[model samples]
Target: MRGYPGRFDPLIYYGKLRLNQTIITKRLTPIKVDRGSRSATATLPRIQPRIIGATYLMIALLADIGGTKSQLALMNEQGAFIHRRTVLNHEHPSFDALVDQFLHTQPPPQCAILAVAGPVDDGIRCRMTNLNWLIDGVALQQRLQLKFVNLLNDLQATAWSMTDPGVQSRLGMLRGSGLNFEQPVVVISPGTGLGQACIQPHQDQYVIQGTEGGHKTIAPFNRLSAELILQHWQQYDYPPSWENWFSGSGFSRLFQTMFPGAPVPDNATMGQQAISDPDSSSARCMELFTQAIYAEAGNLVLQYLAWGGVIVAGGIPPKLGKLFCQPEHIAYIERKNEYLDRLSAVPVALCQEADAPLTGAATYCKQRWHESS
Candidate 1:
């Protein structure tokens, strides 16, 4: 069956008062209001707040669609997620089928916000980078009778994740301190591929700009890094990119580059070995990966003028743990002679929340829904 029987126009209930569209609350916490001033403030009680005119609440389907897995959830305007679930991409026959199954027992979402692991071509359709699936926003909007559907580059979603306090709480400072939110912020995520995005403050909201910085020409931070580039160039018949030595595939690729004749383990196993066995080749590979990450982050910080901060997200960094907190990692970022002070002053943080992308999608959806309302 089609996931929905008819168009969904969410109905909201707040105690005895029934609102038409929006549910306004901060982090799902009860909101208190000054009825005379017609303003709201965060409070502890679940008192019924006066809403002006029709309330504008929308329940959105949020999906972090990646090559290996997809995290699906329904997020209300209060920024609370319900029924979050992760499903293997391959286990489902198609993305549409996967969404249908996920929504099988739930009411159809009013809108859908999808974060996809690929470039959003024409701001609508996306062809998965490492999979055969294709996500089309317009098609989904029609099929589900949704108000709107938006596709974001996965990195764009990760950048927006900072809007959620749940994500902010898990952020571990790798280096530097103090955050200046007035300036731009950047996010670099290395998983199946390298992703980059920047968040620019606009009035009271934020504008997320996706970047293809990962595909930029590679610059060797050191001699060994230079040698790997040559190795990749010789074998692949093209100059290497930052993603070559910076992403999840970097583990296996680095292992192969170091030991030409040895069979390389899978990326996960190599990452574990890097953490557990310091003297092994895996650790050495991780070392290079760490340096590349720092080096590129420095470049991005300078390029974006991201004094707000640089957030390092994705599946790989969290697994590296304190391995990334080493001072040597920041050394790569601070190698800039003139800008060392500026780069050093910018806080570099590690995002530990695995559901960061989903949170981001929810934030994006909520913002768009408000705009529409």
Candidate 2:
């Protein structure tokens, strides 16, 4: 009732494990259910592997909260994934409600690592860029009785997966000569909003840094892109930021403005349609969007000198299919006037996994555990 009407619903499970009703594997512990007026209580099934000489095994909870959906995963101290659950973000009244509903049916984790679609405040709080929700690490820790709770900008967490060997195997190269691990890595995600981050190895570990590059001033690549920016200015009374042209809402808005019809109401549908029907206006919209993405990514590469590589994550890139490989798109990415030679050396790749943020959060938790040990 607290959330938007018709959008809010009872917590729905989308993973292999269930509450007391369904039985999982031998590792699953018995469920303890607690009833509450506002939300039900359940403990996360104790699926931790036994460790000799260790009195207790460490269990981690990873949450990647985005605008459209949230991915939840459980992992062990050793960084082995246990299970994952995807829930629509709007279905729950609040993030706390969603977590409560989840733990209400299962056991709670000792440490909770969350990757959210916003800037984190000292790893303790976040105000989502797209969702009308405020996430507090301190509050979540107390509410869940968690030993540790931390928040990371979605891209900051996704940066961890940039170096993951398994994640690398799934990447689709778009441009650049090759990757060099010695250089810093950059990650750009255009989903509900735009997210950017840089990761560099230091002292036997990676130091992840968040960036507001997505919110920076956007430069149009051509006259058509210039007109789109002018239109955006007319409507908003300010220059459109990179996210305005690089995000889902931006995709639909740009398409409708250019085509003068409401063919598609959202970016997800429009993107999917563009893939299936290459001749449609949706395709044109996506092409323009890709160009903007390329330009912004190139700018980041030049600004940060991220010669290691640039990884594109979130919901858009994967859907673009082989579009990045097209000569025009590749040319746009390498069109830095004076820095063409330097930029051409930078690699660009799409993160093929939809759960890269979840994997990143799990990796973050694992690293923290070891550093503290």
Candidate 3:
């Protein structure tokens, strides 16, 4: 793909100002930091001196590309965050356009790791499931003339962030049960669409496997849910997949079915109503939505035997933190027929930090180039 025509302009600044660049900087657009998570502006500890060698100043560029927006960050090999920027996906015609925009305004990094919202094939090609875009790491690397480019499934990137100190510090316990690090870790994120991934510990490192589990038909937990599934089935040839009822579109569908007489609003409008008015019909829809999600979370835990833990990530879950972490929801998730005890032992937690996927992409870059630094 051809990059948008532009000369490198140093005047336009899109990202956060560097720590050393300005004493008091103003953000062009404020990023809403998650209240439950540690502040991004927290004072960083001093970096230790390297023995008999100068510290590498080379930075790695990281990108978390999703359906709605793309978050980009710059960090040193030492894993210190330098700056970040957010670009709405619609702002660029293609993925290449977005990358070109960033590259034009900033000095190119040694390498880049991009966490995209679809499976990265063996050839490093990913056709975004929710957006009309194709991303090929090899092609992008050649076009940018970067030393290296790594592609990771967005959920795979979120999975990797579990090991990041910043992510770990922000995790608030939903289910207080202890986690067995020896077992596999699974992350289920429901955003514009549903995404599920599992990370298993290998000999010395972890292996992340992104799953199309979201496309699998979901078995209803109750008679009403079963009927709803049937309704969804009647409307489409395909079976009611997890994604059909667990994402933003899912929320809209549920709201429509429950209140057919009312004007069917979009997912964003419904979400605002639910969050603002507890007694509203939207809130009732959210209650059912919460139940369905909890049931699915339990199924994932059992399906993968993810005793290492179950992490609920994405834009939705963390926003409904109060609803997600309710004791009743955990109780519902833990209600497997014979495996209730097994499920109970698997900790369920909300990923408070929204930058988790971006951070995870940075982690991959850090691992690959830390020794060089």
Candidate 4:
């Protein structure tokens, strides 16, 4: 994996691919206005700033900001992955501290596009749901001396990566009658949290958009499942959302709910036990987690009309691919639709690759760089 050629030239390799750069730049453009002087007359662009150095080597920094771990990579303008590293969020007290450590060991890039785990405002301020940190885009750019900086939702990064060749290596192929590039694609990932995004054709290019659909109220198909979720929520006073059932920690909650009196181990301990002993209760928890994930995937497919198909990419699904591939799990997915004839026609697949987010981020940055250059 370390020896792989990571970068590509869009002009040489993807000139005919019809890449979408307009949405990215338009979304990332800074809103011009005075910071302290709120008067309309003072809204003009600041005039005294001197010009910076010309023709700095264009490099892209891609970061995956997840709940448990954050992965960062540096790619050159030519699309080659030059450096890659991962850091545990638990080890850092703040987001700035993590960035400081990352930059201390590896130099900052010219341009940076980070896939954060939450929504990004126009000014680039973001708040990760599972992690305790506030990310300020303007501050980060000024501190790192970056020419360009853009922030995207992590699921959107996964969606953009679907078009890359590297993603093909990790995506399991499924042939279905209705699957086509012209149709929308839905991506549902289950990890520390449940994430959803959609990719749709926008004019000559595709737009990958994020949705907080995971937090939507989960309507159970069966009375037993409904009662179980409701009871768990009632007992814990937690919201009855898809993330409460589809995520890794959600598994432990569900398991404890089901077993009631069984000893509940923490996520790391449970993972270790599950790996060492497949027959442990930890494994059972994972099995149930996969079931909920499949159910959510089916829901997203119907809601999005993802005829381009559904792709499951996350730390959880890929780790438990074999468990997800079981007959019962597959049956559960197929059983959700009364319109089986129509649903069976749609392609459903899993993404087993680890570096999909990184690849997607690289692709996004390269496209933007080409458009601006």
Tens-digit lDDT string for candidate 1 (75-161) = 755667757899999999889999999989875688898999888987679999888998888999899889889999888888888
lDDT of 2 by residue, 39-125 (tens): 544434344334323222556788999887898877765677666688998999999998877666554477889999878899989
The TM-score between candidate 2 and the true structure equals 0.78
Q: How many residue pairs clash in each candidate?
A: 5, 10, 0, 2
- Those runs of model 2 whose alpha carbons end farther than 4 Å from true positions after fitting are 1-49, 52-56, 89-91, 105-108, 231-236, 260-269, 276-279
Clashing pairs in 1: 21-56, 21-57, 22-55, 22-56, 22-57
lDDT per residue for candidate 3 within 105-212, as digits (tens), equals 665676788998887887378999789999988888787766678888888888888766667677877876544457787888887778788878776566777777
Give the range of the ten consecutive residues with the poorest summed lDDT in model 3: 1-10
User: What is the TM-score of candidate 4?
Assistant: 0.74
- Residue 269 in model 1: shift from native, Å? 2.8
For every model shown, what is its TM-score relative to the native structure? 0.83, 0.78, 0.78, 0.74
TM-score of 1: 0.83
Index of the highest-TM-score prediction: 1
For candidate 4, write residues 96-162 as lDDT tens digits: 7887777675645777788888877873788987788888878888987776678888877888788
* Cα lDDT over the full model 3: 0.73
Where is model 4 more than 4 Å wrong at Cα?
Answer: 1-57, 88-108, 174-179, 233-239, 268-284
Pairs clashing in candidate 3? Answer: none
Task: Order candidates by lDDT, high to low.
Answer: 1, 2, 3, 4
The predicted structure with the larger lDDT, 3 or 4, is 3
